[model samples]
Target: MSTANESATANPTVLHFSADNDIADIYRAHLPPGWSLDALSAAPDEAEKLRKVRRADALFLTETPLTRDHLAVAERLRLIQRQGVGYDTVDLDAVRARGIPLAICPHGTPTAVAEHAILLMLAAGRHIVRLHEDITVHGRWPKWDYRSRTLGLDGATIGIVGFGRIGQEVARRLLAFGSDVLVYRAPGRPPLERSWPRDRVRTCPTLNDLFAAVDIVTLHCPLTPENRGFVNRTLLERMKPEAILVNTARGALVNEDDLVAALRERCLAGAGLDTLTVEPPPADHPLFSLPNVVLTPHMAAGTRQAHIIKAQAMFENVRRVWNGEEPLHRVV
Candidate 1:
């Protein structure tokens, strides 16, 4: 979001974009010699993060919303390395305007998020969360009754809403479960890069067709302005009454109010969500009242192994920029 000092190669300072000390430590573990690091406090205020960003040559950002105001003060920033793949939290236009190289660590995200998507798919499909709550907290076992409600991945026709790295990973895992995979068609999307059973993996011509045909739908697309809240009532209505919905991509991809209405009306079977339109959702969020939904705190890709790998990439990019070279995986 800003420029490096004239003597960047001689010495450089880095800022940890978020307040997590552990994540800062992960990046610190890989810090180049003669380089210095500063970390924000846990639960830091906006002003606090801004002050730190202004003084650093590079930053390792996680969830903090890096906006134009922060960029304006980033007088010494030459590079920004997102800890994971998504960059929706950062103001990309502002970063570009400032001529700061923005890079992402895609290598850290795919497998962990893809695995969590399938976990939620199975958890929500079989009502595993409710089963645990009922038996563990209420001291009741409704084992036989559950036979009528349970959904399984085996022999199921599953639709994958996006076909990027995470989507392909999901398809691979789905195959191991004996499920057929249907990829949705988006303009200019590439063909499958690897082999899968031809009959089991192919594209669905339209969102409507995919929504109607699959036993379950899992979202793995990036959040874009054009597709924000695209999964509204009309799209949801096309899904069968027995079908389930799973979203691990971004919260704004689905219309939460519409989803709540659909769930309450029994128009859809259940939902497995790892994100909400608003993070740290208000205590009375409508989704909390539903028995047919399984929710996780947007941690689909929060693995330690991913962190170390990301830190390595982040510093390597920092070193590149410090040495007057381009950053790898540059997003803007």
Candidate 2:
């Protein structure tokens, strides 16, 4: 990670302390005229560096863990702006203790992640990987046999776990494909009749109900300590034998070991994962050997359009905090 500081008048500084410099540039370009922007590279003494720059009004954080010690020195810090939707890496408890706002770019992520989830569903359902390998690698022509195993979205019952921005977007697209959408969110929330007709979209009271009923399930929830490994063997067993599982959300939400076992035993038909319990997983990871799994390097929100939108929202929230207004998408 590298760092750069942009000087602009005597305005409060916004620290760009993330691994990606491109994100810093985005912040620099969009921030209001007088606000200062500073980029800090990841280092062994990162906490010490934060101590030195105790006047940062906001932090655009990615991958770097904001420990309690770092927060103690950041007396002037008003907001911690996550570059993307997930804040699993940040110490939320400490952030709240300081009364600082923690905001995410929710608007920027929905379209890209939702589209990726649908893409994965189609790829896994159609056995695209295997068919491509058969033709391109083995020189086999026209692998029509794959068609028998392929599943279609039309008339399929799709369950979206977590009815937030990303989940709702996934539901919208699936509806156009003529799929029945079932959503499972926390209890006590109002029905989603406003977004979709009550007759068209059914609500599942629990994960078990959703898993048992849907032909395909996509995860769009954030990863938190309480929900870590929520999709374990017992819940997975409830899914239909031919059902496809798609996850564009955090990897730790699902038990990767159990997922592999389910796939190996043929209890589950297929899985499309953009994230893993461990990113850049080891070469010998079991999922890599499975023929029924499709994997991407957690790039569900990596679209160019998403990046620009995310950057804009990230700094906009910072500007909001500076202007003494409540930030958008405040998680803490």
Query: How many clashing pairs does model 1 include?
Result: 1
Query: What overall lDDT, based on C-alpha atoms, would model 2 receive against the true structure?
Result: 0.83
Clashing residue pairs, backbone N/CA/C < 3 A, model 1: 2-77
Which candidate should be chosen as best, given lDDT against the real structure? Answer: 1
Tens-place lDDT per residue, model 2, 1-332, is 11113222245678876643676776677777777888765554765566544868778876677888888888777788887888888877888888888888776689999999999999999988888898889888765787777888999999999988899999899989989999998777777857587776888888988999998999998787789999989888998898999999989999999999999988779999999998779999999999999999999888878878877777777666666679998989
Mark the regions of model 2 whose C-alpha exceeds 4 Å error after superposition. 1-9, 42-55
Q: Mind giving the per-residue lDDT tens digits that candidate 1 earns over 185-214?
A: 578887775676789998988898898899
lDDT scores of the candidates, listed in order:
0.88, 0.83
Cα TM-score per model: 0.94, 0.89
Displacement of the residue 110 alpha carbon in candidate 2, Å:
1.2
